[model samples]
Target chain A: MDWHQLWTIISLPDNIPIVGMIFIIPFFTWFGLRQGFANDRLLEKLEGDPKLARAHHRKTQPFQKGWARELPVWPYLLRMEFLAVVIVTFILMVWSITLDAPLEEPANPSLTMNPSKAPWYFLGLQEMLVYFDPWIAGVVMPTLIIIGLIVIPYIDENPLGNGYYTYKQRKFAIWTFIFGFIILWCSMIVIGTLIRGPGWMWFWPGMTWDHNRLIFEINRDLHEIIGITSQPWIGIFGGLVVGGFVTVAGYACHRLIVATEFTRRILGRMSLLQYAILQALLIIMLALPVKILARLLFRIKYVWVTPWFNV
Target chain B: MEASKKAAAKSAPLATNGSNGSRQLLGVTVDPQEIKQKALMDLNAIKQPTKTEVYKSIFRVKHDQTARSRTLGVLSNVFLHLHPARVNRDAVRFSFTWGMGGISFYLFWVLTWTGVLLMFYYHPTKVQAFRDILYLEHDVPFGKLLRNMHRWAAHAMVLTVQLHMFRVFLTGSYKKPRQFNWSVGVILLVLTLLLSFTGYLLPDDQLGFWAVTVGTNMARATPMLGHEGPFGPQFGMTPFNDVRFALLGGSIVDANALLRAYIWHCIAIPGFAATFMIVHFWRVRKDGGISGPNRIMLESEIKPLRR
Candidate 1:
């Protein structure tokens, strides 16, 4: 099809006038103006007014504020968001299960093969990561970007529109922002393409990674990276079973201990009494396993960042 | 006044006294030849709020200000489909703002729904991802709406974020007190966009495939894409072999890229974004509660714009 055909295919709905939508969509959208007249309180409350009473009093309820109103089951979260995801996941699962093609075998490394990309979402980053050094692309950049994000509210102290900015007013912010966008993230997309090839994307032996880099059991390089010796005991049983458990347990314990110290003696009055108990139990539950596993198998050197989930 | 009402009835039967029907005001009746002079008097009543009444209205526990809250108030009076109130009624108002770690739980909620639904039929492999999308559009139940909402919400999240940025900038909210958080918001925005763009490519159609190809090629223009690019001769690397291979999850858009995109879209980036959003909101609450600059436009000013 021609470009014109593509344009026809993507045209906005008829109700949205072409020229008007450009200016209208943002303003009307931000104001939520089209939420309809009945959705406004002044209009609804006017139902008692002699002029527009019949037209008001909200035939339907207007949403309320403060801590007093009843809320949807998920609170701030929307029902549709979950619904849309669940329905789609199941549908995709069914479609894939029934399809004729085979899921390629347990991923092979020796096969100097075709198409070795990460998940497509990361492909954009992996595609970008190709340009930079490995440490920068894979480790330093992603971590810093994420950590940097944790400080947003502390940085943008503007208490105004809650969510609106003009280009000029936001120049420094907009300019510095481009680094994360066009540079770092785009590099991540490049990484998958540039970094992968046969073995760990490196010529070294312990470039150890399972298909999709699953690292079901941590290996020598991973151990050395964590400043620990590569013991067969740790590799077989300790790392595989005990290490995972104890690490998670230790973190749980730390969180619990912290919580307990902070809790007041008068718990019965606080609604959080149950929550505090639950958190304490979780700590014990995790800590016990760490103790038991360390005694049973090889010792865990330290609580290092795991290959999966980055922590 | 009753006399004027009778006289106006001779022409416009619905005219009421002291309404727009009066031919004379303050005894300055204009002549028939110069009736136009009379038509020009300020043709409206000032909707002036009494100071006493306005103050009473302000404290009237019922009429709390804020556009979103007011909208909900109206919705509550009539249609009762949504859940009942929960005391913290204003939670959903800033539902659009993703605060610190860069996004709200709501956006994650949106991502999860759209991501999972897309995953149901999506193949992480190049050949099938596009077909799956086609199946979703043409075959699945309510699939189009799901896809459309997913796409639109992603777009809305982007736009809202930009607006959120503007709100910060205009208010000078991203200053010393909010600088780091501002930077974080910027990163989150980038991540959000990256998430949206890669998902766009997952379908594996010409649009999806070529867009990635072209987009990456533009990046390769930055002294990469290897040796085959326009500047590849200068850089001394094979063009297609240089930068392009890293993109397609193999040599082309294939299983690897799809799977990678799926994993990141469903998990990693979102995981990171969520962690940050929590911190962002928490800090906002601790720092001084969410910023509430007097940002509402006056109705009278709005009326002129409307006309």
Candidate 2:
């Protein structure tokens, strides 16, 4: 086919924005997994080569006086540091001259901007606001993330893969962080920064920003779909069901952990407290995708909604 | 004639001896030992002549290519204390650390220098903040360059700090005794983000104002500390007493917010981060410098070896 025909074929799903998912999601997923395998192979090669491994160990062995080398820091580190700083300064100077930082009109409280956004760093949390209550998405989740990061070194028992690149040895840590940083955090930021347009709607690359064509989908809560009445008994029953769902889900995850020797070994390294805390955090993270799926499939805005709180 | 010439040469020596005797007779006694000492000093000076004493005293360190002086030079100098006398050869490799940690430090220094200069031209007040920026961009000589450098350096610092964190994580540099340092690094990362965020509000332009608005609104959702947030009533958090209240200094982003951002961006957060950064660097050295290339021996690896 000619270029025109190719363009037309690609443009077929341009109007149907979500249809872009067919091209993006699987492509990135496959690419990510392939890259992961490639890394694993590279790590294996480095690890398996006896001569290379011996040389590496011998070179670094003297420094094992706690991960340091006896080489003088002055000429070595200072020279490197000085060179990097000079180059970086030059680059920054050039870039700063080339582009001006963005400036918009003065702040008007009455005129709320469409697609109001936080700084790029917080765009992940901003995108999370789309799926959950602000309290949970902005505060609780970020707090939990900080806590989890602080506690990782303590909870992680794997002593291997330190000071070197070894994907096979620290696969879980690597993949988990990648999934969080890349898929959850960075992807959301990219989406928030670019794909999101007026009214916080997804405006794909090929599409134009048309405010008139905005589509509003009224979402229903899970309780509303189940036709639960606002009676005292029903409220109690609803609370019970919610509690039951959590307990069952937690138990199922616990069982799955022990069901396989592979998984059991992973958790076997942690104490009961660490395991419980980490598993609970994992479950909370798992709920994010589940809630998104619920919204996509069933048009459920929320699983829980009450006067004081909503989730 | 030959006899007369010999007699004249002998008279010449006698005349030289007679002049020396007359010079001594005038006053000062010259010891033979003193004369010998002067001759020896001159000989020693000739043997080890000074070629670059002025340059050496001013700039060149007393590095005699010996271990003792090298260590002493680094240890004695307050400025050089930041670096150890020696580092792991691998540690100096750009690919190993990606020079990111060092770059972050460089950017921090750049920001500090440019920031102090910018402060000379900037006013944190709402009325003058935007005007000051415009004046700096258009009126003052090299003002725009200084501002741009500061802005870009701030952005660069944030990015480099993140990359540095990623490098540390990937290399598993945070393992073992480095764990506590890792936690401190995490705090530094947060401080970096905070510094960037606080700085975002400084320009008082639309981009900054709304960014600060949206960013601080998240603080309002903080569990017990925000007036509109969860558990607010239990904590008796009003718009006056909430965390967001303390952050913005009010319910809305206004003069107080601008001032607060200025204080934080310019002073508070940097001070906090700098304090941690000192600890971070000190601990890096204390923990035996940047991590080496030794593969972390996990329990699984050890089990195989034991078997």
TM-score, chain B, each candidate: 0.56, 0.78
The sequence of per-residue lDDT tens digits that candidate 2 reaches over residues B1-307 is 9999987765553222243443242235555567889999878767765434654565455757677767777877888888777776676776566777888887888888888899999999989998888889899998888887777677667666766777777777898779999999889988988998998888887777787888888877777787778787788988788888899988988889999999999999999999999999999999987886554443334332121
Instruction: List candidate 2 stretches off by more than 4 Å.
Output: A1-70, A231-266, B1-60, B63-70, B296-307
Q: Candidate 2, after superposition: displacement of residue B54 in Å?
A: 5.9
Each candidate's lDDT (Cα)? Answer: 0.44, 0.72
What tens digits encode model 2's per-residue C-alpha lDDT throughout A1-311? 24543344244321112234335444544543443344456556555775664444433223444554456766666777778878997898887787566556766666777767777778778888888888899899988878877877877766766776556666677766766766676677667766676787877754665566658788987777788867554455557756776787788667766665545676766688877776777677767777777886888886666666777
TM-score of chain B of 1: 0.56
Candidate 2 lDDT at A78 equals: 74
* CAPRI band for model 1: incorrect
**Residue range B1-307, candidate 1, lDDT tens digits:** 9999877766553323454445454345434446655444322212323234554455332444554554455445432213333223333443223231133335556657877876777767655665676678789996766666565456445544655654464444564445666676777676776777676556555445544554454434333334433344566655345655555445555577667667777778788877767666655655454342222211222221111
TM-score winner among the candidates?
2
